[model samples]
Target: MNVCGLDRWLRILVGIILVGLAAAGAIGVWGWIGLIPLLTGLFRWCPLYAIFGFQTCGLAEQKYGS
Candidate 1:
C-alpha cells in the first residue's frame, strides 16, 4: 500500500464540502443524492475503480521510476 499526497487530500476535501453543502440545501436531497458520486470522486480509492482498474491519483510507478 502507499500514501497519497496533496491531490488525493484535496479530492477528499472537495467531496466532503460539496456533499455537505448539497445536503444542507433548500431543495433537499433529491439532488443531494448525486453528491454520493462526488464524494467517491474526491477519494481516489474507489471500490469500483479497484474492480475496473481505474485510478486517478498520482502514478505510483512514476514515483518509483524517479
Candidate 2:
C-alpha cells in the first residue's frame, strides 16, 4: 500500500499541525498542539504508527529493518 519514504498519515498530521501552529494566534491551544504533529513530521517519528501498523517510508524501513 505505502511506498513512499515517509508515512502518509504522519505527513497529513504534520501538515495539520503546521497549519494550526501557523494559526496559533487565533486558534488557541489547538495551535500549540500543532507542535507535536509538526515535530513528528519533521523527524518522521509518528507514535500512531505502532498502533495503526503502518509505515510509509520504505528507504528508512529498509535501512532500519523495522
Candidate 3:
C-alpha cells in the first residue's frame, strides 16, 4: 500500500467517522472533505505523496513505480 498499515487504517476510520458525523448533521458541511482520505485509503494511493516523492509502502522503489 502507498500508505503504511497504521496510516491506512487511521485514514479510513477517521474518514468514515467524519462522514458519518456530517450525515447526521452533527458537523459542518466541510466534513465532506473527509472523502479525500476515504478514497485514498480505499485506492491505496495519495496524490500528495506522489507529488512530494513521499511514500510509506516500505519499499525504496515503490514510489512512482520507479
Candidate 4:
C-alpha cells in the first residue's frame, strides 16, 4: 500500500468531512470529489503515488524493498 499512517488518516478525515458536507448541502457537488481520497485511503493504494513513485508506508518499503 502506498498510503498509510497520518497521510491515510488525513485523507479519510477530509473525505468524510467533504462528503458529509455535501450530503448536508453545505458545499455542493464538488464535495463529491472527496470520494477519490476516501477510496484511496480506504484501499491504501493511490494511483498518483504509483505514477510518481512515492510511498509513505514503511511496511511497503520493507516488504517490497527500495
Q: Write the per-residue lDDT of candidate 4 for residues 1-66, one digit (tens) a residue.
A: 898888888999999999999999999999999999999988888999999999788975548733
Ranking by lDDT: 4, 3, 2, 1
- Tens digits of per-residue lDDT, candidate 3, 1-66, equal 477566777889889999999988899898998898988877778999889977667765354533
lDDT of each: 0.55, 0.60, 0.80, 0.89
> 15-38 in candidate 1: lDDT tens per residue?
566667677794566656545555
What are the runs in model 1 whose C-alpha is more than 4 Å off?
A: 1-3, 30-44, 56-66
Per-model TM-score, in order, reads 0.41, 0.51, 0.83, 0.87
Off by over 4 Å in 2: 1-24, 59-66
User: What is the TM-score of candidate 1?
Assistant: 0.41
Better of 3 and 4 by lDDT: 4
Model 3 ranges off by over 4 Å: 60-66
Write candidate 2's Cα lDDT for 1-66 as tens digits: 222354545665766866765675655655666666556656666677756876567766657744
| Alpha carbon lDDT at 33, candidate 2 | 62
